[model samples]
Target: MMDVPSIKDFQWKTLAPLPSRRVYCSLVEAGGQVYAIGGCDDNGVPMDCFEVYSPEANQWNSLPPMPTARAGVAVATLGKRIMVIGGVGANQTPLKIVEMYNIDEGKWKKRNSLREASMGISVTAKDYRIYAAGGMGGDLRPHNYMQHYDMLKDIWVSLATMPTPRYAATSFLRGTKIYVLGGRQSKYAVNAFEVFDIETRSWTKFPNIPSKRAFSSFVCAENNIFSLGGLRQGRLYRQPKFMKNVDVFDIEQGGWMKIERSFFLKKRRADFISGYLKGRIVVAGGLGNQPTVLESAEAFHPGKNKWESLPPMPTPRCACSNIVVKNCLLAVGGVNQGLSDAVEALCVSDS
Candidate 1:
């Protein structure tokens, strides 16, 4: 018996599409700019295209193509350089190659590769070092091994292994700790949550995510971590169901709290792009019911504990790389029908 709140005023706007269509691209926001890295083309072939977009100039500028053509890459921004790690390669094989692009140099330089080939790696950058974690290897089993890349030493130092093995997990840095949340293990979706403390150099187990789901997008805002919509795997021969369940992990409360059902997302989906904007959790573009791709978008206001509908994206697609810029949520290349060159941003304003 609660009422939903309105967004007040918000809108979706189209930006310069990628020079070419791509999917599974790696996206990140650094210094108020958004970067879209390697992905696959319309033919499902891996691509080497690299590009950057500026919201102020409202144009995309090209960057040197990566040394390797791959998709599903783990990308992180370290200062002025962008690091691209493990991904599926051109020959349809998992790769351990690592490369870094220096914004000043305007070119990419090969770095120390991973010790083992992997895909679906979860990565985060902190204190000028990259922490690379859980992903699927050639054996097809998720690896719990966690490693940190030392930019100065030009090597990867093995750290504490994850308590749970999985791929496609979401990671974010708060203070000196990196929190890794829900992913998939084989056919089952993982709901485990854990954190790694850099100063202590150890892993601590947190409460297992109550909702058994994977590929759910999570973001940090207002000192609370929010895990949004994803898919729950079902019985054999049955389709995996999309979920609108929203769980807020209050760092202060030290436990997970479920938001009201009325505050759930407007649509059920997984593998969608999400970001925190102006105190709202914004989710857009992903897989939904009837074997369909969704363009529908929505947001949740934690203060009001209410849901607001957002203007749908121009192209409905899954696996789109996403990041939050200064005042906008940018959704980069993803697949809709086929590969999409579309680049769009969900705009937020104080007015």
Candidate 2:
């Protein structure tokens, strides 16, 4: 392991805040602008607040809200169109409503909805098609789903179901395959690691994640998948604890890295914002072992196999909707004390 940097590695910058506070909102980048979709308000009620931030002007302008109000929705950007998939609605129940916002047209249009209503769906856009995987349904059970939106027909076609049913899983589209990692079945975390080949239209079961923890982050860096810190479930003899354990899955080798060769994060975190940045695995604010939310940040330098300290977040919060745009990682609305309107970005510093 390399020594901790004496100088700062990453820097934080405060950006123009959102129009209003939001939690569980879907943040996506399209046409070089970041769009914030539906999310819950202070009372935990879903809102149909649609807004976009123009980096050029550093201003946020409101767009027409969605026809339905919902939160925890899966959003994908295709050219000028943004597809908002299944999510929790006003009644605090899962919904099948599917809507697309055409930026060029500046209007929301209804699309063929999902066959089953669910939330926490993992969605990705490739070519012109959208692939939506596992999600939790109204019954609160995770579904072994695998479906793709048929853009030409304006309909959803079911494909091979995943071997392990889960919700809120992280997915990465590599070449023609979609690698889906851990998600939750209910309150319990699912360790299933599976992949779907677009060409073959089938699912292949890979090795399950070595560590089974809730609220863990599964991120893709170069050719490897890293499962970072989370809340480790305890047995009857012990209490639940936060974790800093890190596990790496080597794609070329088709297996996990040796446990002895794996490393650990600098801090134990859960429900944090993480992303692959400038050849490093970066993690920001989240709930740690303490009662208060954490503001610390760190980055794992793969070449050195070491985690170096970085700048802390301007507004410390958890469960923030995060996305990597250009060279910056934007952490949008989250629960800071209460609902927070803070919009901050972790940037690559020249110094």
Candidate 3:
């Protein structure tokens, strides 16, 4: 087991705020840079704006805007370039336009688009290819389409369709498999767990998540997938509910086990950023406790099997895009009372 650090080991700091106040944007890491792609501006209009953050200089530089103005864009880092895929466009329509930005050239290039306009799509890059899976389409239906864009061919090829159609689902690449976890079919949530084998181009259904979530976050830490806080409906038109459930999925074992409540989050927060920092699983900034966007943050040490209170964020926001860079967990633009341009990071030392 790794030595657990005291709460003092974690430090939260604010970086240069994003130039455009937006939410549902695509934020990703590539070539030692963090790129903020298209998302909706404060007025709820889709934006074509794009920018990047350089930790070395503590500054942000504007890249050329994407060709299509859209929000909720799904983005993936492909080597030095970025693939900007389907998203919600202006007029609240799902977009099928796909574009790529060459960081070195500072220009956008077109790629073969998806057959259907998709929103809430989750995309990830591995082995020089991009995998796009479950999302809501313009038809307002959850799509099970699983496709991959082969860089060499500049084409999108369909793979085995997901058995469960859902949107707002998240996929995490583990070895040759991609695990697609909990998402929503509509107002109702789905707890389905499925994995796509990249080598065989097939799908495998695993144990469903103990708690169904749509906008929730499940982060990887300690060689396990920790399904964190989420929001769901209550019975009989009751108010929506927030969850503090801590479900642990052992990657090697292939099953989920709900942990004790003592280890649950300090607050019931959903749509937050959770990631492994050093050896601790750090969660920060999301919607919690009515009328209060959360700034409070906490860390869970696997070795101790307990939670540790940490410093809160400088700003309160939810749906903030996150990507790990070096030893920092970067929280990008999200909604805070309105659209937010705030950018912050939680840094943990090697000690």
What overall lDDT goes with each candidate model? 0.85, 0.90, 0.85
Candidate 3 error regions (>4 Å): none
Please identify model 1 stretches exceeding 4 Å from their true place: 1-6, 237-239
What TM-score would every model get versus the actual structure? 0.94, 0.96, 0.96
Pick by lDDT: which candidate is best?
2
lDDT of 2 by residue, 1-351 (tens): 323323265788899999999899999998789999999999999999999998878889999999999999999987889999999999999999999999999999999989999999999889899999999999999999999998879989999999999999999999999999999988888899999999999999999999999988988977889999999887789888999999999999999998543378888899999987777788999999864698999988776677877878989999999999876899999998899999999988544
Superior candidate under lDDT, 1 versus 2: 2
Q: How many clashes show up per model?
A: 0, 0, 0
lDDT of each residue in 266-317, candidate 3, tens digit only: 7888888988877888899888867479989999978668777899998888
Angstrom error of the Cα, residue 178, model 2: value is: 0.4
Give the Å shift of residue 132 in candidate 3: 1.1
Model 3's alpha-carbon lDDT is 0.85
Candidate 1 per-residue lDDT, tens place, 77-131, comes to: 8899999999999987789999999998898899998999999899988888989
Candidate 2 TM-score versus the reference: 0.96
- The weakest ten consecutive residues by lDDT in model 3 span 213-222
Q: State how far residue 256 of model 1 sits from its true place (Å).
A: 1.0
